[model samples]
Target: DWVTETIVNNGEQYHGLNGDILVWNPVTKRRHELTSMGIRVTKKTLKIQLKMSGQEDFLNLPYHQALLNDEIPLSIGGGIGQSRTYMYLLRTAHLGEVSVTVWPKILKDICAQKNIKVLE
Candidate 1:
């Protein structure tokens, strides 16, 4: 499904999950961060990340507190971009081909110059 492997650091802190990768379409030179799935962080790592990001105050929040107290089960989760997947599967050259979201005229023009059609 036009997937590729890539290494990412601090995924747990940045993505709030582990093992984030880029989804690429080499043929179209298009890419989208389709999903990030990975193991949940332990309390120790979460604390460290919070401190590093100056978000240590988050530890007091119910969700963060639960994580710190190990009240939440360790698990993996992620989000997938449905439109990106549909574009790839349909061999559409641009995201606009599969999505109805408004795009700037300049961007649409640029894509058109590249022979990438955008569905209206």
Candidate 2:
């Protein structure tokens, strides 16, 4: 996890200590952005970010109004890609190798030609 900070767009904000993770695979020479997470923003900072982004109209929305009124608690949140994590841990070259999901026929055929088994 890298310590980072970012201004929120669409009424989201990070109060402090925000970061994202970029996982690298040496064999495939690929990097995947795995997650983005951070602390919730304060009303003051929310207003500032909205003004900066020229999105103050968001304040009219119910969710934004609640945030500005301190109806929501400050908290930390993030997203993670489950299949990507599985690929990294299992050292798989392709996402289909780690998780089962629908794939384009062309993609499946290409992987097949490459002698890559895609688990559907």
Best by TM-score: 2
Model 2 CA deviation exceeding 4 Å by range: 1-18, 38-80
lDDT of 2: 0.71
Tens digits of lDDT, candidate 1, 1-120: 011234356543223444455777765886665555554566777777688778889989998877667787644332236676776678777778887777899989999899887877
lDDT (Cα, 0-100) at 1 in candidate 2: 15
* Candidate 1 accuracy as lDDT: 0.67
lDDT of 2 by residue, 16-80 (tens): 56455788886478887555554456777777778777898998999888776778764434223
Collision count for each candidate, in order: 0, 0
| The best candidate in terms of lDDT | 2
TM-score of each model, paired residue for residue: 0.45, 0.48
TM-score quality measure for candidate 2 = 0.48
For every candidate, C-alpha RMSD to the true structure in Å:
8.8, 8.3
